[model samples]
Target: MPDPQSLDECVSIQQWLQREHLPLASPRPPAAVHVSLYCVGKSARIPEGVIAAARQAGTAIEACQFELVFDHIITFLLPQDNAIVLAGNGGRELWQLHVQIAIEMHRLGADANLNPNFQPHTTLLYDKDVVPRIALRRPVVLAAREFVLLHNRRGQADYEELGRWPLHARG
Candidate 1:
């Protein structure tokens, strides 16, 4: 996880993972790297449709400046799609924020892979085996000041940053 404007953001995450002699992951170059408020899953062929949904979702999520704490390391049970991730510690507000985004997306007809048990996490690496979380680092806290809509084509490295809407709740 990283703060878009923080110089220490990427460096901090790298160092934390490096301490364990672990190799860092090379996820596709993000058009806009962010803590995902919602994942719309596989990219659809109809870009226009996706953009329209995002625009609608933006209206609903105009104010959601939530914080995320990447404190623990974990993995899914699968070996092939194994992943090492930094997860939040039961952040209710964050979940609500994610759910709101999802609800809005669904309202605009986006219901691809909506995992009911959404364990919010940022993947550190993907290995065949369950990379031991024996070396859990201190919490890395990040502000979800903004949420972005990114587009990648068939797992390509390049992504199109469709839009970015900041989170500044009303007083």
Candidate 2:
């Protein structure tokens, strides 16, 4: 089989489908890449003030216009539950950091369901089946300053920045 990590060649037929352009998908944004950080739960709604703060921070710090997208619904295990989302050998390390942030967010009382153990990911393409599992390292670096709140629609969750904080090298 072809190496999945290889950048020069297609890893498999599945990877090709993932890359193919889709009509229903949101067009990629120019500023920060859109990524899912945590699940805040149905009951835990983002306060309007928090959303305002994040919007201000995102534009002020990043120097770009920000908008929210209610595009996808995803799931991931948390470390608190003795379950972790690992990005396999070929998985991205950023994802690991996201999980850590989720745990921290949970500790801060954002919402039990949405806090720690957030499985970070972005909606690239839609699919009906469960996502393939991958290995990843723990305690990845993430910025606490940058976060958005999104509204839930059906099973799909939309994302919007709720607040922004600077991430130091230590975090």
Q: What residue runs in model 1 are displaced by over 4 Å at the alpha carbon? A: 4-11, 15-33, 43-47, 77-81, 112-114, 134-137
TM-scores of all candidate predictions against the true structure: 0.74, 0.35
Residue 135 error, candidate 2, Å? 9.4
The lDDT of each candidate is: 0.61, 0.35
lDDT by residue (tens digit), candidate 1, 1-171 = 255543255355545554554555443222323454567665457467767887778777745566676666676566355655666653877677677777788888876445568787765555555656543456767776777776656555555677777778646
Residue pairs in clash, model 1? none
lDDT of 2 by residue, 1-171 (tens): 111232112112124334542223332222223445445454455575544443443343321222222222222433322111212221333444344544444455443343333344443334333444432222222223234544444434443434444433332
lDDT of 2: 0.35
Show where candidate 2 strays beyond 4 Å: 1-16, 19-33, 43-110, 114-118, 129-145, 149-159
| Candidate 2 TM-score, true structure as reference | 0.35
